[model samples]
Target: MPKDAMAQKRGGWIACPDCDTLHQCGPVKAPHDVKCANCGRTLFTRTENPLDRPLAFALAGLVLFIPANLYPIVTFSFHGVKTDNVLVTGVYRLAEGGFPGVGLLVLLASVLFPALYLMGMTYVLLCSRLRQYPGDFALTLRMTQGLNRWGMIDVYLLACLISFIKLGQLATVLPGPGLYCLGGVLVCTLLASLGFDPDLLWRRFGARSDKAGSWNLLKPKAS
Candidate 1:
């Protein structure tokens, strides 16, 4: 039987993340990237060292996160007086201005959530690299996904730029060390998420096809 036909018989199929087209999932030769059949988008590439890339990203994110919250993101100068704003100061300013709701939102999405997200991702990657189970691996993976969406460092950066433009006429706005660190944080976290493959973790844990959920939709059938 043809590979695709046999895959269908064995319920080993995978849906493309981009186009949702079903394809028989099977092991490809090492060092080749997999592409979606319908849209031809790259699905996952085989890396010479899978754990190294993701682990490096996660560590970099964690390192940058500290400076992101510590240094002043921007400084405003008016009439020769200057004021610096760090991550917490921004949140406090929002609250003091009577936008308590917005303050809380900024606190969670920008400050606390991003920290947790980075830490969680770092922990997961470390555990996977060590080949050691860290509590419930699947549950940690799901939680990390939720945190990933909530971390809005990029959105915060956009807001800072808008504020700089609008406030520039009234005061001189200068990007600070914190602003650059935040940018680094965003880049590192994004790269970490992109490099890590959840399917590899599932397979490592010995999950059966039935337990693979949506991932099994692409499994190639055995010959």
Candidate 2:
């Protein structure tokens, strides 16, 4: 039998050679593996990393989250007057500056999103670890995925750097310890998210099993 035919006979994971799209192989699988439903990539063999690594990263991210939220994100000065702004303070400042929208956006992006991502991921990790079934693991997974992209502390840090460089001549702009902490938080959380294995979650949560009708696409092939 051809490789594709063989794949159909025995269930397995396949990656498209042309575009690296992931596909679950079996009789009950989605139609037409010839073109990846996600990226239109031709089907090919591929390997997936185990879930333990991502679980570790998720735990580390939880630890870093505390400091990320506690520390000051930026500091500013003008003509001998200086002020340090934590994440919430910055949002308030933005509102005071008549930029309520910007302030709310910043708060959502920096404060709200990161916290939600961290908490959500933590819950996923813990629940998975305990082998406890959540009512809506799929929904939680989606929220975590969405929040992960918006956790833009690095971008905000770069903006801080640019602002400091521009204002240094007129006023000093020194980075506080919190800035470093926030960076660590961002890096750790990013690593955690990357390390997390969604497949593992499904397996542990009983979302994927032989009884689930042979095969169901857990995650779409990445383009």
Candidate 3:
């Protein structure tokens, strides 16, 4: 039999997300992580409060996201005159100053993508907690996972710090409430993503892989 057919025969095999190596899935005690044999990437772990932990972090990230965008991220002072700028301001300024592409990139990376990610994650967690899968569950979940790289708030925050250091010699730059809030959002979103378990979601929701016609390892059994 082919490898895929062999995988089907194994009954409880899981493909490694990193290297596509199939490993038989077995229940393990808490505090132990399931690692991929080929790539050594962690596939799963017995988390005590999987849903609750990520849900809390997602909620916190959503809350902080509001203030992160609304308030000024930082303030710049030149010759005693000060000006504060929010997240969008930098994008607009970048566009107005002739870097429209960079502005749009920043807008998507810093503002748009983070908001979508937070909302998507919040919705997914809510549905998972309620044991209900909405019509758009799969699409939403896939998009949330896909945008993980595009949501670059951490990178944006680091850029802010670098700007602060570089501009300190010419003028004064101070952290604002929004900057702190953005930091909080970044931290919360990161924790939420880390704590989130896709396998758990698949098992609970009976999510099927559209690509793999015969793969149903995590498919929930009918009652």
Best by TM-score: 3
Candidate 1 similarity to native, TM-score: 0.76
**Cα deviation of 37, candidate 1, in Å:** 4.7
Candidate 1 clashes between residue pairs 3 or more apart in a chain or in different chains:
13-217, 13-218, 14-217, 14-218, 25-219, 25-220
User: On lDDT, who's better, 1 or 2?
Assistant: 1
Residue 131 error, candidate 3, Å? 1.5
Candidate 3 structure, TM-score to reference: 0.84
Clashing residue pairs, backbone N/CA/C < 3 A, model 2: 54-195, 54-196
Q: What TM-score, over all chains together, does every model reach?
A: 0.76, 0.69, 0.84
Write one digit per residue (lDDT tens) for candidate 3, span 27-128. 444446789989999987656566788889989999999999899988999999999999999889999999999999989999899889988888887897
The alpha-carbon root-mean-square deviation between model 3 and the true structure, to one decimal in Å, is 7.4
Query: Which sections of candidate 2 miss by over 4 Å?
Result: 1-52, 208-223
lDDT of 2: 0.66
Alpha-carbon shift of residue 78 in model 2 (angstroms): 3.8
lDDT winner among the candidates?
3
Per-candidate local distance difference test: 0.76, 0.66, 0.81
Q: Tens digits of per-residue lDDT for model 2 on 118-211?
A: 7777778777666566687678877986787897777887887887788788777888777787777778777766566554455445543443
Task: For model 2, give the 10-residue run with minimal summed lDDT.
Answer: 42-51
